[model samples]
Structures are given as C-alpha cells and as structure tokens.
Target: MSSPVILEDLQEAFPGWCIWRSSAGRLWATRNGRRLSQYEIDHGLCQTIDADDVAQLAEQLREQEAAERAL
Candidate 1:
C-alpha cells in the first residue's frame, strides 16, 4: 500500500489546524481544536479535500491569515 501523507505536511498545509494519522493509517484533521477523523482524505471520497488539494488549501489559508493580520 502507498504510504499515507505525513502529519506534519498536512499541518503545514493547513495552518492553525491539527492534522495527523492514526496507527491504522487513518487521516485526521481539526479546525476548531477538535480532532475529526477524515476518512474521505484517505479513502478518496472528496477530491477537493484530498491530497491533491493541499496546495489550494495552503493558499486559501495563507490568504485568510493575511486578511486576519490586516485587521
């Protein structure tokens, strides 16, 4: 099986959120400081929220952070 995405990489892509993987190779993500297992990320349920969207998410997050800093 292909290796799952690293937790640190996901966390970097999604700043301010906590992302990690379980021993069972499950991916988890949290935005409100609450951990939620994102099976879709592992099972390819949502492309927009999957590994391919990492760059997009990172850009969006950067924009949000910049906006927040401007306030």
Candidate 2:
C-alpha cells in the first residue's frame, strides 16, 4: 500500500536539522548551513538516511537501525 509522506516524520528524524521542499518538488535537508538531497547521501556518499527523504527514508532507517541493534 502506497501512502503519502508527512512533514512531521521529517521533523522527528532530523530534530537537529531542517527539511525543505523546493519549488520543483525536490526534498532537501539542511544542517549546519549545508543542504543536500536524500539520493546524494544514499548513493553518492554511501551515507545513511538523514532528513532529506523524511518519512520515505525514515522508515528504512528505523528498520535498519533495529536490525543492527539486534545483531
């Protein structure tokens, strides 16, 4: 089931950062005056999900964190 993402999830995941939706409908996360996209961190930097993807990426992040803790 596909569901629409919400802004609150982004806030919860990135309490230290801020999420922005550009006019072109692109999502970005900014922290410490730096901004980047979810894809950039996920693929380019091989980094974990932050706030760029918000709920979309947050679910994956939460699941991954849970699995790692179980190990």
Candidate 3:
C-alpha cells in the first residue's frame, strides 16, 4: 500500500541503499555496496531486505544499520 511519495521518502532516507516496490507489491531494499562478508551474514546482515509495508521495511533497515555498526 505504499505511494510514490513514501517511496521517494524511503530513497531519500536510505541513500546508501536502493529501495523499491516490486510488481508483486512487496517492498524491497538492497544495499548499494559490495556483498556482505560471511561474518556479516553470520551476524545478521542481508543482501536484500524486504517487508510488507514501509514501517516494517524501515525497521529492517534500522536493524541492518545497527548490525553493520556492531563490532
């Protein structure tokens, strides 16, 4: 149920990632850098983050950011 305005907001908020809504209507976020290391993957980093709504996707992005900053 995301609108274009919300999508634009998400893109602006997550400059380091590519965010979009799939044709199927699912929200997706992919990091705009190299692939995650095995360690990062083991720690919870993902290549693609997805959610059913904007709020859920934002929460996932926040969590992903925290994970990247973690030692």
Best by lDDT: 3
> 55 in model 1: Cα distance from truth in Å?
0.5
Candidate 2 least-lDDT 10 residues: 43-52
Model number with the top TM-score: 3
Off by over 4 Å in 2: 1-4, 32-71
Q: On a 0 to 100 scale, what is the lDDT of residue 30 in model 2?
A: 43
State the C-alpha lDDT per candidate: 0.46, 0.50, 0.85
User: After superposing candidate 3, which stretches have Cα over 4 Å from the reference?
Assistant: 1-5
Q: Give lDDT tens digits, candidate 1, residues 2-58.
A: 222455665655566655545665554445443334653354222223223444445
What TM-score does each of the candidates earn? 0.39, 0.40, 0.87
Candidate 1: worst-modelled 10 consecutive residues by lDDT: 43-52
Cα TM-score of candidate 3: 0.87
Model 3 Cα lDDT, one tens digit per residue, 24-70: 99999999978888889999999998999988888888789888899
Question: What's model 1's overall lDDT?
Answer: 0.46
- lDDT for each residue of candidate 2 in 1-71, tens digit (9 for 90 to 100): 23336766655654644556767765655443545456545544323344445555556545544543554
How high is the lDDT of residue 66 in model 2? 57
Query: Which candidate, 1 or 2, would have the higher TM-score against the true structure?
Result: 2
